[model samples]
Target: MLTIVKGPYLQWPTEDSMTIMWETSEQASSRADVLMAERIHSGYQGNYKKPEHVVSTVSNKGYCTIHQLTVKNLEPSTIYFYNIYSACEKGEIESGPHPLKTAVRKGEPFSFTVTSETGGYSGFDQSNGRINRNIFHQMQRYRPDLTLFVGDLVNDGQNYDDWEKYFFRPGKDFIINTPFYSCLGNHERNASWYYDFFAYDPPKNYYSFDYGDVHFICLDSTDFIKPEHYPNSAGEISSGNAQYDFLVQDLEATSAAWKIVFFHYPPYISGGYQVEELRKLSPVLEQYGVDVVFNSHTIVYERSHPIRGGQIDENDGIVYIVAGGAGAMPDWFLPKREWHTSQSLAVPHFVQVVVTSNLLELRAIDEEGRLFDALKIRKGTNGRKEFL
Candidate 1:
């Protein structure tokens, strides 16, 4: 049988398409059945109302066990029930009657979680695994529609061992059905391993997507830092380069109510690392009136006051949040610069963001289920944002 090895993780869910990705033990042909389920009663009885105009694309020929199947032409803002089917020389295997939700309509209210520095199995003992599970469970309780993983999903840079240890197992319950997008951290150092494991946007490691009233730009921070370590297309973040060029064009073109950017490093923070490439993009971010920026690599939790042109201006700048609290070994305060830091703490936590047509609410929750900080950004009809 085509034994499942990793994932069935949901990805890039849109009005008309949602991708289901998984890894298997051997080369195999795969298929999925998309059905509509309608509530009948208290016991959760629902009908298997089959969907039409659906397309499934699979690579049943490659020696690589990674299988990415996108179910296309689905109804907008709809609910779906699906089952995975795979065929191999050993046998045929099936998974789930899982429920999936498509994108919300524009102007609709939505919620999602943002976090990095996760699944550091080697960084902790068996009991630490419980801490990882605890943090993940707490976030899951919030029931986010999607999740933005800033980076460091595992401890080691390259290998299936690290993958299974830190990420695949702990994330099984929450990530499988949730649409998970990512940024590349130092831990995901191997070009082939990082790119091969988690699926993001097409062609390069950076890309933008829209859901509800928000447009999200997921970037790879290591692009300019370590060009020698990745593909030629991987680490280009300078001006006029592919990544920077894309950021300019992408932000210039987006008309979403809220624009949020995420990457692995903080250009200005008390993190373990900082860089020119990331700091260089701050102007670009502020220039476009990007609502907020999320970053990781510090292994601490910090939120800077709204900053514009390198200064805090509550009414005119974007808030930079450092949320490296996804189970990685703690890297405490390097040194906080008093001018911009509103709050900073060493903890394992995640940020939950709720977006509406007029508001963006963020909450930081720790491993013990404490809400340490909360911020609200109010958006006027003219598209200007201010802290509330």
Candidate 2:
């Protein structure tokens, strides 16, 4: 079967660099091809021209294959068409003429998409899988600039073949065109397919990138230890000392207008495992003035009020959002805390975030094109706190 998975659009230090990724069924004979073309929008017709080709290699896991392609020296804020293909001695099998756009140069305003909990669910009914597929189709209508996959891209992370059957086949169109970004989910931690297919900076598991005025930090949060083997006090898997140190240095060094962090697990959650193993890193986030935290894994959509020192502090608190509804089925909850301002127990969904000079608007839309939740944060001047 034909499959497609994409993301973790890591921006290289240079203004002209970017990383693109995807996965397929069996390994292709050679590398996949990528073509870029300018976007032309007329009164009633839109066209793409000037195809530029790039090739990508496949990383293998049994019969499954993960593919990655990094394109550099591209113009910022420009739209282009791309595609993937398999080349062999006989001929080439093509995937698409999809489209994507590079991030705007530094200091310019831009928008992107963040989603998670899409495919695969153990113990839950197969209906959960169908819900995720529906959401993926619906999300395409918005045509986001970029897409960040929070985690659990597939239910059986160990089954590379399943990854292809479940995720890639359903989202190929979105994957080929959009510069997708990603993080490791608990499901993904069981195998190396995710890492092998995605081109990340050194130390792979954790890295940071800058786009426009925003600094994006991606972290790995799978608790690898067996639940029965660990003591109650043991925590979730975290970025060892090396990753932590890198984050400290990166955060301190960044001079962007916004600092955003995305990971598989939530530091604070009301269901399906509460509190992250890396709670120790919360202090570092607060100290660095991280503007927002995007998390997944609960299969539910929830957002925390601005919090500081482990408590709600509207003015100086960091906004935490759990966009787990991307495709996974929702979990039952009674809302134990006030931090859960908005939630949806209906269809699976994803989030769309738009950042302007004065405000950051967050919109949660479900598979049916219904608005489930929304919130906004206004930026403050003079380095003081601003409330919604």
Candidate 3:
């Protein structure tokens, strides 16, 4: 039997609750066991082993199944090494000895990595081969607390084989230890494999997670608003009403020092696509006071100036980043006059976000370990602007 494919770890509402996901080739056993250890060492040796935690079987597809195990009563900001395995009468198929660190208690500082546009094949010369290896290598070097993928996990969303190959072989090591979050891209519109692969609390395409003093909101932009729906009119943001509603509630409910949103498409991009296409959802994002928005569809690295209500506003505007270069080839498009794009680069890269009590630093790093662009956003006071 093929080994279990682990991936797409999304944090739960609380730090104690965590959602784990994995896939198997054939049906071996119905029971799966999760073991946790505290204060693990580098070489995977320690006296940190929690009692075995049994998870309930939630759903299953033809050869894929999803199991959710919620671990409660965990210490804040602590490291927990865990393993998952199939329980059988004769023996078991073990996965792990992997380790994960819980979110900081509150008002603490942390760091994470954000990347997208990986695991795809546009053509022969533009394959995402190097991007995959580079990202995994960077993960090993950085060992970030969390990882977020904006979209395009696979070239074709319906191709289950690609998903298994891309994530299982290349991304398994990072997913097992660090909690990876994901959003749906245009490529995933026709595929249901994402839901089957990742076990989220709400069982929806979009969700929110809180770490340290920031709230990360993952959005599904493809189905939420389609270009076809608005023929004579511009595009309408109706792909995922459930997601928009959730966003409203999630943003209002959080009092974090920073608010960041990650999605597949750019609301304001200088790419080949039309500009008015993003007008539909611009209002909602502006109303909720989103600090930064990270997007990845164009396969190019571009950053826009602060934008609010579809206009560039430096003082109280959201910083938009297009980081589609995870593994996709760079697009050769220039910025339009209306975009007010501050900086643009066609390099394939990923972003490293470092969060502190007073400020948030975002660095766009390319595959060659070069910094393409850097931005420092300071925290505001009582909804007022605060600058460096």
On TM-score, the candidate that comes out on top is 1
Ten contiguous residues minimizing lDDT sum, candidate 2: 4-13
For candidate 2, what is the lDDT? 0.65
How high is the lDDT of residue 38 in model 1? 50
lDDT of 1: 0.77
By TM-score, is 1 or 3 better? 1
Task: Give lDDT tens digits, candidate 3, residues 82-181.
Answer: 5555543344466655566777866777888888766643442244476676766676567777888888887777987777656556766676667778
Colliding pairs, model 3: 37-48, 223-239, 224-238, 224-239, 224-240, 225-239
- lDDT pick, better of 1 and 3: 1
Candidate 2 lDDT, 240-348, residue by residue in tens: 6556677788998987777899987677666665554555668889999888898887777778778778787777788788787654444444446545443444357
TM-score of each: 0.90, 0.82, 0.84
Taken over the whole model, the C-alpha lDDT of each candidate is 0.77, 0.65, 0.67
lDDT string, candidate 1, 250-275, tens digits? 99999888999998878756655655
Off by over 4 Å in 3: 5-13, 30-65, 89-91, 121-128, 230-242, 335-339, 386-388
